[model samples]
Target: MEIADMFSTTTIPFSGITLEQVVLAVIIAVIGLIAVKVIASAFTEMLGRTSRLSALIIELLVRFFSILLYVILVLIVLATLGFDVSSVVLGLSAVIGLILGFGLQDTVTNLASGVWVAAFRPLDKGEYVEVNGISGTVTSVGILATELLKPDNTYITIPNSQVWGSAVINSTRMDTRRLEVKVGVAYDSDLTLAIRVATDLMKNDERVLPSPEPVVVVTELADSSVNLSLRAWTKTADLWGAQWDLNREIVNAFADAGIAIPFPQMDVHLDGTH
Candidate 1:
């Protein structure tokens, strides 16, 4: 008898709804939640397979669909339980709008900015960029933030709103980059020999592009030395490595060629007038 009583349908107090209706509502809600989860997973997988869609866009789509599906499921459950689902939906919409407008304004702003970023890409994943004074390689752009992997392998997260508003400098956009190296030579050193040594050093480097024909010229004549400006063109990918290698090699080559690389020195005759 007790076992049968446990399954018996009884009227819930205060409301016209039966206990069986409440139980059915709970069961249906659970099933709907599971269905929503499955749908969300499928949609996310589909978006993931599409190469053109950005990560932020995919995330937003999945979340939007999930929320819509759950809201519909809730309304169905409420209607089945003999409640006025229409009034509930209207009230929820109004309340949610007010809450979002007042409390979640930042979230709304970030979402809007995220959409802008996905549509007009100022930066892309795997590219090196400087935004908001922090320079790093971008890993992913998401609905709320942009993730960056710094040189030290630490991760940085910047809000989408901040990123969209700040200055963005993308270093990897160009195919070729110009490298400038300045070296000061002793005033007595043969300026012609210094220029030739620097130019040959740059030309010999396979990483340096030949079309530009690396230039070496006197940029400034200082009090103690003459500064030779060495400008070379190289593929952007090889610029840093080439710059480091050429800088060291130029110093050594200058020494070997008897070109005197000068240091800051001030010559003063004991000023008796002072």
Candidate 2:
């Protein structure tokens, strides 16, 4: 038998569909996937340039359209392979409905929660938030899950249902944040001078906002030390930096001013009689 004859006679095992038809279907699928990818990228870039829509909406739209394109591609492939596309779709719909009815309640819940998340705009992409006790920057809000990038660069995917059900703390949503620094000084230290020094430190820092006016107050008088709380407001972006710098500055300032920050200590009493 000639090579061409062998090629022409070969049929997919058990099925009447020929090898040539399978190859064509495979080609169509590959091309469709590539096209879908390209279109999705273009769509994402286009939406990304717009300021009217939030990042969460952009991600949801891109994900939805990509899935839709892939579904259409699958139907096309089935049609090309001589399968009844309409019947396949109807069968798929029935199968999906059955699956949802059985044990896919969580999936449905996640999808519904995703819709609520998008609608309510609780947390958006690029915002740092704590959702359900997990703190991270939101990378994407998808149909079923919300992706986050942690401070340590670790990635987290929380189900949308959990995210929506729990409280979400958005740290970056506000323009300004109040930073509180607590330092304990020796009980003998002058409380008035300590407050003044701490207040001066905050006032000198350029990151600290002048509007609210930083205040230092004696919060507690412990057995070993008097605790001072320095409260200052700064731009949200500058909060961490201002906090770190103020802490270091306060330590040095106390040292320069002869203010002793006391650690836990106990004087041992030895019985002379023993």
| Top lDDT model | 2
- Candidate 2 residue pairs that clash: none
How much is 106 displaced in model 2, in angstroms? 0.5
lDDT, candidate 2, 56-132, per-residue tens: 77778888999999999999999877789999999999999999999999999999999889878999878999998
* Top TM-score prediction, candidate number: 2
How high is each candidate's TM-score?
0.76, 0.87
Alpha-carbon local distance difference test for all models:
0.87, 0.91
lDDT of 1 by residue, 150-202 (tens): 99998999999998998999888789999988899999998888988899999
